[model samples]
Target: MKYPILCCISLLGSLTAFTSSATTCPEILSSKQRLLNSTENIELCEAFQGKTLLVVNTASQCGYTSQFEELEELYQTYKDKGFTVIGFPSNDFRQDRGSEEQSAKVCYLDYGVTFPMMARSSLTGSSANPVFTQIQSQAGVKPKWNFYKFLINKQGKVVATFPSSTSPVSSTLKNAIEQQL
Candidate 1:
């Protein structure tokens, strides 16, 4: 009886310590977003806290849609080094496919994207989602077109913003990611 009680107490203390050290959601990543083609939603900070992130606003029919391949390659290259790429499909520029299924198919099957691609959402102006709104506030700019990217450090700071024309594998973006890692 004494041994069991001691073990229980020890376990309780361990759980307390673990909870205390867990990362809290920063204001920028505080919103919950649904994953593409899934009913499930993930709290951004819970999924990405302490990770270097490249957040991209994507569109299925844009000229820059091919950037998904390069983005995936970039993700695979440095994903193990505390880095991640998060894609958010948006239609604010009026280039997305007709529906969520089409968008998910483009991301998951057509592009073979293995990174996290969120469900379609508004990505510009007053209707922008919480994450992008916060990003614009911090970065001083918002997505002017599809495939715009924002690099965020582990501390949730927006380190850099790249326009639609900047390739994911471009030296400037890669160097910034490397520095953050």
Candidate 2:
């Protein structure tokens, strides 16, 4: 979907206007938290209701890249139980800068990513995103690298944060995600 110049500018503006701090991510999302998904650029939270989301900071060229297979597997296994993995493609680590269209193509073609994909951006540090800021506020430790996962329970609350090394198929993640379901 094509975003109007106004929309793009507004998103950047809202993000930029945010007070730069170590604990300011949640506020940004709470205020301007429209969906940043790939599908028509729908509102992220709105498109997903009454569901448990596994929000991951993803990259196309990371060692954990293969986790996409396990992610898809987990999604297929628990999706009926109201669980999903939301992929947020990021270049924060300087690993992925492919266009959104290309991201969708490569994700599906390479990793077989079937879940929702967000637009590309940073995920940590002073240049962190509103969503990540919120996750960090709740999850404590920030992402170490690409493939780091944040589990959001059905009520839209941040429940747990996993490092990038956490495999998608690990019983640890599955159990954590299922506990809230």
TM-score of each: 0.88, 0.75
RMSD of 1: 2.6
Report the lDDT tens digits of candidate 2 across residue range 1-181: 4678889998888777753422333331342332233445554544565688898988887777788899999999998888888787887787776666666666788777777666776787787777788887776767778998888877667888888888888999999988989
Task: Score candidate 2 by lDDT.
Answer: 0.75
State, as a TM-score between 0 and 1, how close model 2 is to the true structure.
Answer: 0.75
Off by over 4 Å in 2: 1-39, 125-127
Alpha carbon deviation, residue 25, candidate 2 (Å): 17
User: Number of the top candidate by lDDT?
Assistant: 1
Query: After superposing candidate 1, which stretches have Cα over 4 Å from the reference?
Result: 1-23
Q: Candidate 1 overall Cα lDDT vs. reference?
A: 0.92
Indicate which candidate wins on TM-score. 1
Q: In candidate 1, how many Å is residue 180 off?
A: 0.6
